[model samples]
Target: MEINHLTAAEARVWRAFARGETVDFRESPDEDPADGGDWGAERTLRAGVLRALLLDGPRQDGEVPSLSVAGARITGRLDLQHATTDHPVRLRNCHFDEAPRCYAARLRELNLSESLLPGLVAHAVHVDGILRMTRTRFTGTVRLGGARIAGSLYLESAQVSAPGTEVPVLQLNQASVGADLSAPGLRTQGQIRLNGATVAGSLNLSDARLGNPEDAALDAQTLTVGGDMLLRHAEVHGWLGLRGARITGRLDLSYVLLSNPGGSALQASSTAVGELWLRKAPPMEGTLNLRRAQLDVLFLEPDSLPQEVLIGDLTYTSLVPHEPAERRLPMLERQRDGYVPHAYEQLTAAYRRVGDDHAARLVQLAKQRRHRNTLPWYGRLWGLVQDVTVGYGFRPMRAAGWLLSLLAIGSVAFALHHPQPLKAGEAPPFHPVFYTLDLLLPVISFGQEDAFAPSGGYQALAYVLVLTGWILATTVIAGVTRTVSRQ
Candidate 1:
């Protein structure tokens, strides 16, 4: 880089690179360019000059060779692909004519905070320190895929817009970050993908508004995070897919407003998390899928559940807010993917683990009813009988009620109609209550039942009483056996 070819702004940046001082091009120290406009030659620098200074700048014994320029308008492309630099680059509040391409470049810290750029393509780049892009605005896609960062990646309050594109505006696919990917208050018009990305620390996206209504707003399939993934108060217009993701800590989505009508609002199938916080979130417009997801603790509310939920094989060890079966059973019933027995069984186990036996029985009874709907007609009819009589062996009191009612009917009928004796004087007295009791108790003879023979309507009543007694007895035995076997 010759001194004669360098412009005034580039010359100043060149002089300040080794001194570790920022070259502020604003009219005053406190002046901030609102839209990064109204810049003349005094605030203009060729990107090639900046790149040359970073690559081959003069360094002193104790000075760190860094490029810190603010409020400058960079022209041309800053292509540093496959390049290596030991300097920390900080281009704050700068405007660029072309997007900076640092693909496969290895550097120290790179901070572009509050800058206005066309885009950034740093795919496969290795950053030794933090990659800060806080408050920056990008008009095109910011591709950081396959990048390995030793420190955290900050995108707080950054806005990226790339409409009418099938690709994501912000792509971090397969990137490995040693620290957190903190992006609170981040707004994007297109999808933000983190597919197959591995973060050693937490991924915080609190209060982000991701807008991709026709498709997925955020696709993080197969993402592995060592710490918590916080998306609290975030609003996603399209489906937020987290299929096969594994988070070591909690995945908090409290107070989120997801809208993906006619599709799934959140798909976390096969995801495993330590804790899942979905409390106080409004009912989503689409399905909340948790098929095969495993969680240690689930902080959810029945009223906050979406209309269509796909919790086919979701297993949670503990549920917060500790609601009863009446409130939680509806969540299992709302699964539109037909009858899932595992869902009911999981809820039953969850209740039972907490020593809520009554709630567990209620959930088990609901499981029978849901399973009955999938059976054949005859099986369903038999199930209905079991349900109405004894709640499919879960409500034993119903059997007792039926038995007492039948006993009362038989006693009253025999009290009204007296039967004739089979023999003239060898027959015992026809005591109605005793005779009815004898007729109702199968395999038991009270001697009066054998001595007296009923005629006409009285004979028909005895036959009905005997048949009812057998049915009630068999049902009671079957129900009690089933209940005891379960225990």
Candidate 2:
């Protein structure tokens, strides 16, 4: 129905939409327009200068269709309170110079695509269909607090300019979305807050450049996503805070460059993700905080093939035990390149818990290689010895050396205690030779009287000689046994 004629109330709404003035429904006349069942449909409100005031009460379904306010400069509030639409509401290329309020409006498939929106405000705005805003430019604060969207919300190529002129930027606080929130190629100069927003589908921010060196950037707190959160190739010049955010699927951050040289860069505490992929990302200048984050096996796979994957700082439980040399060597080698110091520390801690101090120290040393090779040759030799002793179970040479040392000590103690008897034509036995033979030998035999006599020292010498011969024979026998076994 055509609404060319203006009653006092209709005239006020027309003047508000035309001049961008805020209409205070509380202060307006008490006449109820819907009581007469005459809500205007297909209404056109053209160019006007609007100011600050409220517009209350609900509008009938299909009561407003194809409302166009093209090229109009909205300087104040424009509240479409509790308004429901059956068809798409188009507001193409409208310039909002001041804060425009549209609280609790039920908009189905609203199209503000390519609109120059600056300082726009929408609290509790429920959208049923797609809210398409392709290439829209938001220069000041634009809020969508407590809004619920049922379909895909596209903000493709939208440029949210810096908030320097006493105004803030886009905010979507406590908003819930049923489908994906795609914002590909979004360039935000000011902060874009999406705190406590829930998304049923993926949150795609691919190729989005956010924040400036002098201003605050994206602040997405407690954002819960059912699907993957893709931020591939996105560049954040300031802080990108995602504290307490939870993603059920993988958090794909491949090729993302987050540069906050002077401030905290990326903070994602208590965040949960299936896997966090950071393949080919540039070296982060600031902290990439993921404190108390849970990661799965997909994040721990080797970065090369037959196991080719991206290698980075990862914190996870040990995949190998402390005793197996074969299993631990591969993991050690993986830390040779791209090893984050904190991740290496985590790995070492896990190893230490399994009583694998040698492996723990090895990883620590490998991580130190990034800064300086402070480990000396002797230190590395000691580390190698410890590794072999704990990991390989190869300590035959060590056992043999200890056994020989004990025998030498015992022989010396016996020689000093008992003096040799002077034979008529023979000289006293040489002590060194006796001790050496006793240590090197494996068998000894002596009569009881000879062992107890003053001449027992000579007998001890004889016992050492016989033991040396027996040890040589046993070695020869063992060699033959091994050869026969091999054959």
Candidate 3:
């Protein structure tokens, strides 16, 4: 602390505090703090007075007052820029004419909890201890850009209302917190921006009301949190964006009611979370976009899936479903229309990554079935044929089975019929079984079926074998082409 002499006016306010006087900033004693401090006769003290009291007040040997100034109206701006003070300043229930400018200020601790003010501007401020502003009402924007706090930021039940549309009620841009950003039960008219922020502890937003409808309720882009980001049981009337964020712990949205029309309710693209939980939550009103996210675990509840969701390149390590894959896969469709192949692919890939091959196959099979159901009647028929014959171009063994069955039947029919010898042929006697082989394989001829004559059911059956062989051969070629192309 730098030692400094106080100005005459500064000394008067200092002496008054030392003498235990009630400094009244309010014009009328009848007005409540909820009136937004508009009718206040503020007593503006110079910055030097505060600096002097913090520097020399303790050494005055109990001469300084307890710094209690309840219902006081602080006029002008209380500038604490770049001043490092160890003493705690707590002005409870006070009204400020202008916002307290604490930019680049280092403080031991601060408690303005339950006070009515225009706003709070605390850019680049570092507090060694807690910064409490709980239950306070702000008529303007509370900007905390680039702040570094050593302890928790308590704002539980705080009401921050920004006048204009799309303006942020509370801004914590690029701020670094050592502990939680506790703001449970907070009511705000504008969005809460926490872009580029880093929190060492959890972010408690339980039971809070956030943002106007269709606007971003909470903007947390590039935020890195060491602990959980809890939004459980909260009501968000707008979008909750967490793009490019990294949560080392769980990101809980349990029982949260999110509503954003036309756009996504939750846009968490490129975010990496330990667990992306949505258990017991009401179905989100808008799209729950999870594009390019890396989630270690996904915990979803029954009938609680959002009305629409689009997941592209989303990777999860596990899916905790209470039902079997057969039942679960059918109900997991979140797209409003058309089949999304990536949805199935993502699920299959996640199961495969966890070494659950059975689960992966089950999801893949369900994917094929559902995909076919979305097609036209003709398309569905074609899909069925492909599935039955070659398992959607994935089972060549089934094609082999069909060919072998036809070949065996052809051989038996020719042997029972006993075809007559050819009139003009160098091969003396026509062997019935060998003749059947010639007709079956279109690509190869053994010079027997070409030279023999067969009567009765033998002739009709031989033609059938030829046609069936052509169909199987063509399908095999088509399936092989499709399989190779897909790879």
Superior by lDDT: candidate 1 or candidate 3: 1
Stretches of model 1 off by over 4 angstroms after superposition:
28-34, 443-445
- Poorest lDDT segment (10 consecutive residues) of candidate 3: 1-10
Q: How many pairs of residues collide in model 2?
A: 15
Among these predicted structures, which one has the highest lDDT?
1
Model 1 accuracy (lDDT, Cα): 0.89
lDDT of 1 by residue, 82-166 (tens): 9899999999988888899999999899999988888899999999999999999998999999999999999999999976667
Tens-place lDDT per residue, model 3, 1-487, is 2224543434545656555454545556565666544542234444345655655654445553534445555666777888777666776666677788888999888878778888888889999998988888888889898999999999999999978745687899899999998999999988899999999999889999997777888999999999998888999999999999999999999989989978889999899999878878877888888878999888876556676776766778787764456655754475654477777887776666667766766776567777999889998987787777777656778888877777778777776667776575555576756676677667887878767777677778878878776766676777788657644
Two-way lDDT contest, 1 vs 2, winner: 1
Q: How close is candidate 1 to the true structure, as a TM-score?
A: 0.96
lDDT for every model? 0.89, 0.58, 0.77
Model 2 lDDT at residue 434: 56
Question: Compared to the true structure, candidate 3 yields what TM-score?
Answer: 0.74
TM-score winner: 1
Segments of candidate 2 deviating more than 4 angstroms: 1-65, 68-77, 97-99, 165-168, 214-216, 297-487
- Expressed as tens digits, the lDDT of each residue in 1-487 for candidate 2 is 1234544544555544434333433222443222212322222232221211122222445344234333333444565666564544555555554445567888766667676765566778888887777778776766787889999888889887755653346778798889999999988877777889999999999999987654456777899999988888999887778878888887877788777775556676667677776556765546556666666523322221111112245455543223433343354444324444566666667767678766665565455443333457876554454333221122234434544664565566555665443453354444543544444454542222222333455556546545544644444444345335523
| Deviation of model 2 at 91, angstroms | 1.6
Compute each candidate's TM-score over C-alphas. 0.96, 0.58, 0.74
